[model samples]
Target: MKKIYYIILLNLLTVTFSCSKEDDLEPTDIRYDYFTVSPDANDEESILRRKFYEDHNIHLLFNDTLRHEQRGTYADGTPHWFTELLDLSYDITSTKNETRFTYIRDHQKQKEGIRYAETYILPHLDKELRPYSIFLVETLEEYGWRWNTVAYYNGKRCLALAIQGIAELEEEEIKERCIDIFYNIVDSKTNYYDEELNDFIALGNKLHGETFESAGLSDDPTDEEIYAFGFLTWSTWYQEFPSESSDFTSFLKAVFYQKEEDFKVQYASYPLILQKYDIMKEVVKQKGYIF
Candidate 1:
């Protein structure tokens, strides 16, 4: 149901079933607001910290930042990450303080591995990809996790960030809308694109329609907006995809990690993934983000 020109990119990247051909719809230079987001984000951690202090710091007795120099950029510079090691001091309980530092120490190594593994691959991932970023585990776990959340940590970092390197209404406005890039959690609903909102918005859908073409509204929907049609799409997934869903996390593991060849079996929703890519690719192009 999402529309046209972007289909060219999806068609080339994915498969015939995954992407349909309706290659006539060209992009408009109208400067639509939703696709206009371009974050010149340099201070990732500081940006997140500020958001926490503003409205999310009520529970922690004490929390602070720690820095360590590493070997990678925030996907900008080719090799160095975490440019400096800042000496941070905090006065929380010993257990809490130790836990926090342990997390930092762990990420110093893990983030480096992630960089090494995906640095080359990301640049080739549809020019609009965001660098891989994960909210510091301490910050996310303490403030945002919903116990055993699946893609919450892995998928967004690998799949979503690659889909959202720079996005935030503003730096101080970083309400960890980081995940919102994956699915626009902030503005998700059951409505269609409200031209009045100056932003592309969506409301819920039953997804009872025969196909993605039928279930979806515009053929040009961003992946986030399509996902805004979550509850229904998720329900239908289990009926067709072999991936059985017990919870959100389980559903994610099944859908994201499933084999592509396997998606065509009995009830697979293969074309949907292709449609998701079309919207994401098109939006990024409109926003002028680099690959």
Candidate 2:
């Protein structure tokens, strides 16, 4: 009787294993489509984008709408998901933490943006310092404030440029915007050497308790006053001190845009300023940038 019971248990185990093996061999009806279609070979815009990708290692998205995903938790701790269509707008409200929806519909402006980048922006920037992708859009407003010509986003370094009125802008205005955007990109992307940054911060600290307002300096400082106070620009002086990373970026912008000789002469009276300038200059140079 015991042997018969054991035989029955073995048969049951064999049947279970056979059923599991059969289930494993069954095919499922699920599919995943993750690959992006390549641009048309004969398209002029596509050719230009491909060239940028090949030459500068940048993905120039002139005619594409990017999908931005944002995830967070609701007030009651439930998960919330958001999908935003990235485009340009002039009157985006700050009430919601998202921009108003739009699309890149101006082909002329898009082409102009690409040409402007090729002519003035891309040539000046080092390949390593360039953002992975540049999105040309109609207008770019962050949180309903800071109407910027260019803004950098995320570790992948996606850059967005507002090119709504590219054709309408004067030549000088276009050049200024290009340079401004270039410096802004460099300021945000370049990683400074720690020792150099700390030294620069130390120099800034030495000027503690002294501000342009207290020193009787002009709110809009002349070149001479800017050097004397060891601040490279009125904006940097306005910061009062460089206590954070963003403040350091301000210093970098001031230095990058100023002529080297003028910077040296202006900050001559302040040893700390000169020291900070030298440190900043060296660090930037090491990153294959000239300012």
Candidate 3:
């Protein structure tokens, strides 16, 4: 029944997605304010009715109230255009969730590729206004879906959209942090990746800074570059800890309702993924996000 509902939902999402394939419809010009919340938006359904009044004089749009968001067209561009990728529904199953879900279950390879490809072929991942600037790519590996390559948790720090190896994470502190980052992106308002996150890469470690510099990038790194850098760097950082997904998020203090932003942003600076890398490593070893 869930699968049936999923199919029906996909069809509906795609129904209106058959818009012009022309390059003329610039993303910045697309009408994202397609819906409006009434004055009576205090109900459970209006939980994510969105504070459209929060519009900024910036290039990116951010919606902090949503429980879930998506980066690609797995849902045929539904809940799109803003940095939050806003979807208020409590249990929306998206491409990211299914991708990570593979780790929860053994590979059902027969279906993953085709489903993933079909999802990827859709007109999601709008580049000009691509969420967090993370783009999509195909995997050279024999298995894994194409759109599954990258994912981002709304409030968690694992902004995995361009990140590889990490499964689709629909969980964590990345959510609130994501909102804060969006606020930053809009408030700061220059080209986001170029100036705002330039220092986010690690410098000396083999995981990120030096590795990114080794990529021969010029001027600044693209969103994909930052995602790759975070994935490689953090993967190595958490490598020594117990190898469970829960444990990994704990070590990084990436769970919900936690004050991990200080820890996250401090490391988010260019020199290393964690400024107090030693501290987090020890904290995880001692108890592991249990406080």
Query: Which candidate wins on TM-score?
Result: 2
Per-residue CA lDDT of model 1 for 223-278, tens digit only, reads: 45444443314334433211112222322223333433464342244344433333
TM-score-best of 1 and 2: 2
lDDT of prediction 1 = 0.32
Off by over 4 Å in 1: 1-103, 106-111, 114-125, 132-257, 267-291
Model with the higher TM-score, candidate 2 or 3: 2
lDDT of 3 at 264: 61
TM-score of each: 0.25, 0.57, 0.19
Per-residue C-alpha lDDT of model 2 across residues 1-291, encoded as one tens digit per residue: 999999999999999998888744555755421111155465766676677677667777754344434488899998786644333321233322333313466556667777776776777667667666776666655554643333322223356666666678898787777666666666655644466576766655455444566667656556666556555434454634233454466567656677778876765677756776677777776655643
Q: When superposed on Cα atoms, how far off is each prediction in RMSD?
A: 24.6, 9.2, 22.9
lDDT for every model? 0.32, 0.59, 0.33
Taking the tens digit of each residue's C-alpha lDDT, what string does model 3 give over 168-233? 534343343343333222222222123323232223223322333354644355544544333322
Ranking by TM-score: 2, 1, 3
In candidate 2, residue 151 scores what lDDT? 33
